[model samples]
Target: MAYRKFRGTKLFTGKSWAPEDSVLITLPGGQVEAIVPASEAGEDIQAIEGILSPGFINAHCHLELSHMKSQIPPHTGMVPFLLRVMTNRQAAIETIQESIYLADQQMQKEGIVAVADICNTLHSLETKKSSPLQYHSFVEVSGFIGNTAQNRFDQGRAAWEKFREFGPASIVPHAPYSVSPELFRLINEFDPGCLLSMHNQESKAENDFFLTGQSALRDLYTAIGVNIGFFQPPQTTSLQAVLPYMNPANKLILVHNVLTSMDDLVCLEKHPVADTYFCVCPGANQYINQSMPPRFLLDDQVEKIVIGTDSLASNYQLSITEELKLLADFYPEIPMSHLLQWATMNGAMALNMDKKLGSFEKGKTPGVIALNNWQVTRLL
Candidate 1:
């Protein structure tokens, strides 16, 4: 039987670093066969110039918005960025399809083995079906008005069901500001065990709106011709306002905690939801707001912190290595091995794909990737 053996500058098993003398052995198709000392490995061992680790798991991405790349200007703040996305999302069907295809191909080449992708429409369904990367579709629902709650829930549920037929999919709220109390309640009750991903505290405007009911978010609603007069300020942070409606049985993934504060973290600790993952897309945050999530988000307070590329609309590219490199540059204090764990294992666990992806454990077929001086390439 032919097996592939690899030794790199360093070997990260997705969880931790392998021994210096370890040589990774894998079946021809990339399944983990063993991690043996160099003395025991045969003469066919391959050498790598940089770190070898399992393929990355992108815990949060907006694949449906891939067509909106570069259409929205940078450093425009969240409200303006969102307004532009709403205004320009519509395009020729071929254009949308082509962008999704290209984005999918880009992820595969960058060593993203699986993704927890946001889907507002079926535009990406065919591409995901044929792509080598694994995808868990998150059908995002949003309705700020109480009256439209049921309709929005129904529409999102219908889309989720179609995606479920194709692969793993879930119905999730788009964001705290965009989801009404009624809509949140409906989504929580839909599936107790479902994985819930929400756009949480990406901007100060979100908490400002929830606390005072008067913010740029209201202006955004007005621009779209939606009446938000019936809405009232909850006199609390957005996360606190929405936590009660979240089912404890669900594994919640909070994406883009750019403005998540200490108070919010305390509130989260008191909440019943035990499994919470904080997914940070620094590239998108920097592009839209010229800011990054507080360094504390990577501290001990956040037990699980995963990385994502967001989408072409807010990010320059879909590479997790770029995201990691950006993170390394921003927070030079954090170790690369620690960041790799977040990019791979934490992300895979957040998406509930850890058993099959993330680490280089025997019997797991986590695709092999080589990070040569921050340049990413798939080796298997």
Candidate 2:
């Protein structure tokens, strides 16, 4: 069997940096063969500059809204940005398809091997079917009104069923503020063991809407002709309010969390799920709210934190390396290894793809990539 041997730059095996003299050995097709000493690697060793690591895993993305890239202005608060997305997301089918295709291509070029992508429609189904990347589709359901819960779940179920026919898919709530208690119950019961992903605490308005009855999110509902007058303030943070409705057995990915506070983390510890991963989209958070998530709190409190690019709708590009660079720039105290683990191993674990895509374990086929000064080159 033909084999590939590489040495030179530091090797990040997705969990830690390998010894400087180690040679990464793999089959030509990118399957993990072994990591052995330079003397053991034998003849024809390939050399490269920069850190070589496992391909990136995007824990969260919105592929269906790729067409709205650059159409929504930046730094508008979350509610306004969401409202604009609602208005601008509608486009010709050809345009939407082309955008999804391009977005998938871009992520591939950026060395993303697997993605946990959000879907409200089947716009990305065909693209995903033919793409080389692995995907876990999150069919998002939203209905704040109690009476509309069933209808919303049914709509989301239709999409979920379609996506599951092709790959791993789940019916998940859109967010705490946009999903009613009844809807959450419906989603939990639909698939008791299914994984979940949710937009959480992306803005102060989201927390304010739950803490007090007044927030721009309420106004957003009203502007869209949805009366939320029947709702009452929970008098607590959004995550705490929604905790009671979630299934304790389900593993959950809480995305964004731009406004997630230390108080919220404490409350979460009191009532934890089976497994929880905190996914931060720094680019989207900066673009939408002009604010950063409390990374210090997340790093201190959370065990499994991951990174994402979100979508073109709310970000300049879909590159996990760029996201890591932004986080590294903002928090220089964070080691690059931690950020790489977040983008690789932790993200794969978030999407339940860790066994095959997170590390250099024998028999696993994690793709390889080289990063020099944050520029990515996909090797496999």
Candidate 3:
């Protein structure tokens, strides 16, 4: 392969940073030939930058809801916001498409390369077919608990088969809080050989219902005609509740872990067999609960945490860079490099694309992101 060099004042070479560096990245058949100091590369530099790093990867997003940017009210509780979302669902589709287009442009400008996007059906298929970014489309299914679980599972299976022809990465699931244990078991049987993504403990009400069989969610369930008596409150934590149905061989990417407690983290540590990951959507958390995930629970599990911009409907925008800035503000002690990995490499791993798209390692096709005039250094 012919080699190209990138000279930069600072280069983030996947795991670490090098000041005044040059990356000899081979092209055609993409691979890293060598990563040497800037003074070492002879003369074939293709680009020069003040700061360079691997392209960002968004772990969770609802691109179809991109059109709801600023349309949803700020700081609304999850239940009320979801009700509003359902009511305005039809009007949001066209705008969502437009949002996807604009979001693509914005992501590229801000240096994103791949995304784990959640889609309800065919809404994002067309947009994804044309976008330059890489995406893992999680076909979203939702229905009130009951016989509806099987029906939704069937619908999910049908959608998965239909869209399977569209791309290499596609999966299906019932949205959390909406999926029954039986349906979740059905999903676990698939063995997709990739990380499972789901909206885990995004709201306190969800945790409350699952833990104690009582919360605001009960009201919502009753209103929707879901038989409360037949529903046995989950005997375990939300993480444990979903564990039986998750593919044991594959990693699980838990999105919006807003209510995860210390005990939950301890359980995760004990069950080391489950390659669990956390994708924190701070903006979306702030929107729904006026709070963010408990960073303190992360502990020594920094490598297992990733970043995601949930959806424009519940976020300011689909920008991972902005998420990093927020992380910096909220948890300043967490190294910036680690934060970048959460937005980039860790996210890629969540979608099972790490081998080809996470870092600037040998054989990865992920692009490089240039950050100009940003002085934050040493991200590990």
Name the runs in model 3 displaced over 4 angstroms.
Answer: 1-3, 19-31, 44-49, 92-94, 170-176, 192-194, 269-273, 373-380
lDDT of 1 at 2: 92
TM-score against truth, every candidate: 0.98, 0.98, 0.89
- Candidate 1 residue spans exceeding 4 A from truth: 301-303
Question: Which is the winner by lDDT between candidate 2 and candidate 3?
Answer: 2
The candidate that achieves the highest lDDT relative to the unseen native structure:
1
Candidate 1, residue 368: Cα displacement in angstroms equals: 0.4
The global Cα lDDT (0 to 1) of model 1 is 0.90
Clashes of 2: 0
Q: Rate the local accuracy (lDDT) of all candidates.
A: 0.90, 0.89, 0.72
lDDT by residue (tens digit), candidate 2, 245-361: 999889999998888888887888888778888999999998988777686655773458888899999999999999999888888888888888988988888888988998888
Q: Write the per-residue lDDT of candidate 3 for residues 145-247, one digit (tens) a residue.
A: 6567777877777777755566644454544567776676666676555556778888888887778877788777666667767767775667766565556
Better of 1 and 3 by TM-score: 1
